[model samples]
Target: MRLSAEHAHLIRAQALELAGAQARVRLYGSRLHDHLRGGDVDLLLELPSLPANPALLAAQLAGRVSRALHGRKVDVLIDAPGLKQLPIHQIARSQGVLL
Candidate 1:
């Protein structure tokens, strides 16, 4: 993983705070590969439920991540219950490394 210890710690902590204790986080995309470089952190947050204003929540999470990373890009994808199934979601959950 390309993430520094601080990065990983902040990510998990932020996920817990943004979602809940029961929430699970996964790391995916180019950042997960050692040979790859200069890509944003791709995170999958599996939550029991989703907020009504998910875009606002995502933006808030982005702000938190940006502060921690000192402006580095972070992509947060929420996997909420009862959402319409999509192939991208399947790929993310299946291929992503659980954190």
Candidate 2:
């Protein structure tokens, strides 16, 4: 992964703070490739239960994580019990590394 240990820790801390302790986070996309450079952070946040507002939660998490990373671009995808799974979600799970 492209993230430093500190960056990964910040991501995990922020995610668990917002989504609760049971939430799991994964890092995927270009950031996963060491040979790649200057790509946005792509995260898959798996929640044990559905959030009341998935979109808002995603945006909030993304914003907070971005700010924590010194304004680096961050994209978050949420997967939860009641939400419909998309192809991207499958790809993420397959390619992602746990954070």
Candidate 3:
């Protein structure tokens, strides 16, 4: 993966800072393939293991990261505990870089 440690740290830290320390973030998609070029950053964010409005929490987290990574198109997918599995989430979890 070409994702810099700084960016990864920022991604994870931003989730912790804006949301909570419990958020688990992963990076997936083209960014993961060194052979590929110029694609938006794809992120799968597992919401903090807490009780809250998952959708709103996801939007908040995505907004913070989007701002932090200015000029980059970021696609953030959120997963809540016990929620039904989505294929994207499965792919990300299996192959993505854990931020």
Among these predictions, the greatest TM-score belongs to 2
Better of 1 and 2 by lDDT: 2
Identify the superior model by TM-score, candidate 1 or candidate 2. 2
After superposition, candidate 1 runs with Cα above 4 Å error: none
lDDT of 2 by residue, 1-99 (tens): 799999999999999999999999999999999998899999999999999999998999999999988899999999999999999999999999999
Q: Quick one: RMSD of model 2?
A: 0.7
Q: Which sequence of candidate numbers ranks them by TM-score, best first?
A: 2, 1, 3
TM-score of each: 0.88, 0.97, 0.84
Question: Candidate 2, residue 42: CA error in Å?
Answer: 0.3
> Between 1 and 3, whose lDDT is larger?
1
Clashing pairs in 2: none
Order of quality (lDDT): 2, 1, 3
Evaluation by TM-score, superior candidate among 2 and 3 = 2
- Local accuracy of candidate 1 as per-residue lDDT tens digits, 38-78: 98878877888866767776677777987888888888777
Which consecutive 10 residues in model 1 have the weakest lDDT in total? 50-59
lDDT of 3 by residue, 1-99 (tens): 868888899889877775676778899999999889888888888774643666676677677777877867788777777766789889999999888
